[model samples]
Target: MSEEEEVELLLTELFDWYGYDFTNYSRASLKRRIIRLCSLDKFTSYVELRYRIRTDTDYLKRFVEEITVNVTEMFRDPLFYRTLRTDVIKNLAAKPFIRIWHAGCSTGEEVYSMAILLQEANLLQKSLLYATDLNPSVLEKARKGLFPLSQMKQYSENYIASGGAQDFSKYYTAHYGQAKFDTMLAEKMIFSMHNLVSDRSFNEFDLILCRNVLIYFDKNLQERVLKLFDDSVGPLGYLALGAKETLKFSSIQSKFKQLNKEKIWQKIR
Candidate 1:
């Protein structure tokens, strides 16, 4: 069999062994990540990689971290956060309290970004933010609320563009070339490991931000995940996707009204 066919069998075995269900992920990207992992670990072939995965649970956990998406930063798209603050937050403010889910919240930058926005809006005190990712390693870093000091400059710029003009430095203290954010924002967030491919939604949310995450999945998986998001959102709840993702062709497309065709969407039906 070809290497591609071996990958297919390996993915199935991976699911059966670890319950990750990577079978429906976009084949090209998943293969790339797997190949990258194999190369880094000095595996000569997928057969060797598969052997290690089947026998080494501890190594599998580490392997899972490498394959999953974790590239994220605070206020990733300034305009998206700008739109949330200007249009979405006010609608949420009318509520007695709010629940926001930051799905795929790698390293918690954008999750804290949302928390900071809510604090500025005087809504953080009344909000519960759920931040979830499939990787626990990143989640641990996120829970600590520290980011590299080198990143603070760019993050500050993003904060300003997202309509936060305050001294962004005031939010975190610098030590040993790293910036640790205050616990005030962390207090309102609950971080957990959640896999979109294999896990079901656990709660109804007023707003769900799974931004930039769906682009990695195949259309079938994206459709399933979109429907899952649809079911997880409460009536009139909002969803903010990546600039490149949309509900336009999904089965749940008509059920949601366009808040912003490329970014924000509202469940109307």
Candidate 2:
């Protein structure tokens, strides 16, 4: 069979056997990731890779992690967070209760960052941050709120650039090369597994952040996911995307007004 055919078969098996639907993902991206996984695992043939993935549950977890985009950090784009601080959070502050969904929240860094922003605005007490990812392992890590201490310096700089005035070190305590964030920051967070490809909207949100994730999806999947977001967000709610993602020509374009300087949009209809 051709490599492309093999891949199609594998995606079908994954959905049928594991209930993970990746058929609509970008073919180029999936091929590259599968190739890399094969090389990294030293598979003698695609058959070997396929067999291991089909029979071994442990290996399947690793396979899913490898295929999905999970790289994330706190305040990834300082200017984006700055805009959230200056524009989005301020508008949300007036609501008696705020619901923010972090779709594909990898490892919870950005969710913690949002918690800090709300805390600074005195809105944390009234806000609920729903953080979801397809990978359960990452969600478990996110629940702990621990990250490498070495990353704090960069995150601290990002915090300052994003208009933060307090000592960033105060947010976490470092021990043995690991930084454990304050439990308070995690108290308002709800971490769970959600697959955007097949999951339906669960709650109406005031703000939805799905940064840098749509790039891995094909146009059709992106449109479907965007519509799911449209249904999930209340009128006047904000939708945040990654730097490269946009709603310009999507099905929901007319309903959202894009912020001029950032990849954020507010629902108008």
Candidate 3:
């Protein structure tokens, strides 16, 4: 069989046996990741990996991480965070309680970024942050709140560029080649494994962020997930996308108003 056909069948079996729904992910990108996985693990073909996942639960867990892992950093795209701080946070401060969901939040950098933002604004006490990803391994890393200390210099610059009011270094302590973020940032944050493709929205949120995530999905999955996000956000709530992602191609495009210079959108009740 051709490689394309093999991957299609692999995706099907992956869903049927493992309950993972990656069939609608962008075909080229998904194929690249899977092929890379096969190369890394010395599998002759995609079917070999699929067969292993079918028989070994541990292999399945690793496969999930291989495909879903994404690059992330604290206060990534600093300008976006700047816009959020100046434009979005002020509005959220008026709410008695705020719920924010960092959907597809790989490794929880942005989740911690949000916590620090709220903490500075004095809004952290009234806020609940849900940071979720499809892979449990990434969520575990997020829960630990440990990152490479070598990256602290760059992250600190990003924090300052993102309108951070205090010393970014104060948020984490460096030791043993790692930086462990303060516990207070994790206090109101909940980390969980949530598959955007197969899972339903769990709660209504004042803001939903799925940054740099949907670009991996096909149009159908993107629309499906956007609708799920739309339903999950309350009236007059906000949605933030990656710089390259937009509501222009979404099913609920007309319902949002782009308020800031960034990608944040408000659901026009």
Candidate 4:
């Protein structure tokens, strides 16, 4: 079979054997990642890769980790966080309770960043942050709230640019090569596994952040996920996407209005 045909067969086997679906992912991106995984694992042929995935449960976990996008950091796009602090958080503060969902929250840096934002605004006490990802391994990392100590300098700069005035180092303690974030920031967080391709909305949220994730999905899947977000967002709630992603021309475009130049869209209808 051709490489493309092999990919189709592999995706089918993964769904049938493991219940993880990548069939609806963006074809180009999925293929590239799959090919890269194959190369990184030194698979000489498609059959070897398929056999390993089919027979080895441990390898399956690695496969899932490799397939999903996990490139994330604290306070990504500082200006976006600034907008969230200035515009979105202020609106949410009016409510008695705030429910924020971080969909596709890979490793939880952004979630912690958000918790810090809420705490700074004195809203963390009344808020719950639900963070979900398809891969459980990343969730486990997120649960630990430990990040590489080497990255602290950049994250501190990001925290400052996001309008934070306090000492960012105060948020975590450094030991060995990792920085363990304060447990207080994690008290309000709920981490779980969720598949956007096949899962329904579980709760209505005041704000839903699914940054940089939809770009990996096909147009049909993108629309489906957008509708899911629309259904999950309360009236006047906000939906945030990545710098490259947008709701324009999607199934839920008419229901949301973009806030300035950022990718955050507020539900208007």
Candidate 5:
């Protein structure tokens, strides 16, 4: 059999064994990540890689990390956060409390960004942020709240551009080439495992941010996920997508009104 076919067979076996449904993921991306995993594990061939992944629990743990999305940074796309501050926050101020759902929050950078924004607006204490992802490994790292000190410089600039008024240094302490964020910022957050594809709506939220994730899904899966988000959001709540994603052609497009040309939408009903 061809190497590509062998890799596909291994992936199919993996899904059947672990119940991790990655069959619908983009093929090119999946193949690239799997090949990288094989190299990292020092496997000479896909057949050997499959054997190791099936027999070694540690190898399976690493496999999960390889398959999951872990790319994120604080205040990513400064304009989006700026828009939230200027538009969404202003409208939410009158509410006594707020609940935000950060779906597919890879490693909690966006979650922390939202916490900082709400804190600055004097709403952190009254808000609950639910940050969920399918991968438990990244969730653990996110819970720690420690990031490389080198990243802080750029992240600080992002904060300023996103309408931050205080010194970003106040939010974290530097130690041994790492910066650990304040625990108080994450105090009101509940980090947990949630799979958008298979999980049901558990709570109604004021704002649901599921950015950069749907791009990996097919149109049918995208529509299904959008409907789930719509059902999970409270009436007139905001739903934010990635810059390249939109609700325009989805089945539920008519149910929401575009808040901005940058992929922000709101449930009108």
Candidate 6:
């Protein structure tokens, strides 16, 4: 079989056996990630990797962790949060209550970032955050709200750059090299398993933040996910994407207006 055919079979087997669909992911990036995984696992061939993934639960878990790609930090791309603080939050204040969904919220750093923004804006008491990810392992980490204490300095810098008004250190307590965030910040958050691929939209949201997640998806999957976000957001609600992502070329592009030239879109009535 050709190399292309072999990779195709591998992806098909993964979906059929594991129900985790990478069939719609960006082909080049997915291929690179899988190849890296194969090297890390010391597999001589794709077939060997497939066999291990099929029969070995531990191997499969590692495969999922590697492919799901959890490279994220608290208040990542600080300017994005600054935009949210100044523009999105200001516009949302007229509403009596708000619901924000952080889709594909890996490890909950961005989730906590949004929570902190809301808290600083005095909107936390009136807001509910829905943090969802397909990977259960990352979701568990997010639920714990613990991060390395050494990373707090960087996170604190991000917070300040993102328009944080108070001492960022006040939000967490460090112990044993880990910083556990204030439970009060998470009080209004609901973290759960949500697959953008197979899951149906559950509620209308005032704002949906799905940053840095769609770059992995192919055009078709990106359009489908964008449509889901469009349908799930209430009239005039806000939608934010990664700096490199946009609503252009998507079927729902006409449904939203560019709130920020840097990939933030607001639902148009």
TM-score of each predicted structure versus truth: 0.97, 0.99, 0.97, 0.99, 0.95, 0.95
Clashes of each: 0, 0, 0, 0, 0, 0
CA-RMSD of model 4: 0.7
Model 3 segments more than 4 A misplaced: none
Candidate 2 residue 254 Cα shift, in angstroms, is 0.4
Q: Could you give the C-alpha RMSD of every candidate to the true structure, in order shown?
A: 1.2, 0.7, 1.0, 0.7, 1.5, 1.3
Residue-by-residue lDDT tens digits, candidate 1, 1-269: 89899999998898888787888888999889988998889999888998999999888988888888788899988988898998899899999889999999988999999999999999999999999998888899999998999999999999999899789988999989999998999999999989898789899999999988899999999998998899899989998898789888789989988765348988899
Measure candidate 5: CA RMSD: 1.5
Model 1 residue 165 lDDT? 77
Cα-based lDDT at residue 159, candidate 2 = 95
Encode model 6's per-residue lDDT on 36-104: one tens digit a residue.
988887888988888888999888877877888787899899888888888898899889999999999
Runs of candidate 1 with Cα error greater than 4 angstroms are 260-262
- Residue 35 error, candidate 3, Å: 1.1
Which residue ranges in model 5 land beyond 4 Å of their true spot? 2-8
Regions of model 4 farther than 4 Å from truth: none
Q: Could you tell me how far off, in angstroms, the CA of residue 211 lies in candidate 3 after the best superposition?
A: 0.3
lDDT of each: 0.90, 0.95, 0.91, 0.96, 0.88, 0.88
Candidate 1 has an lDDT of 0.90
Would you give me the overall lDDT of model 3?
A: 0.91
How far does residue 235 in candidate 5 sit from its true spot (Å)? 0.2
Model 6 per-residue lDDT at 110: 90
Please identify which of the two predictions, 1 or 4, would achieve the higher lDDT against the true structure.
4
In candidate 3, what are the lDDT values of residues 109-150, reduced to their tens digit? 899999999999999999999998988888999999999999
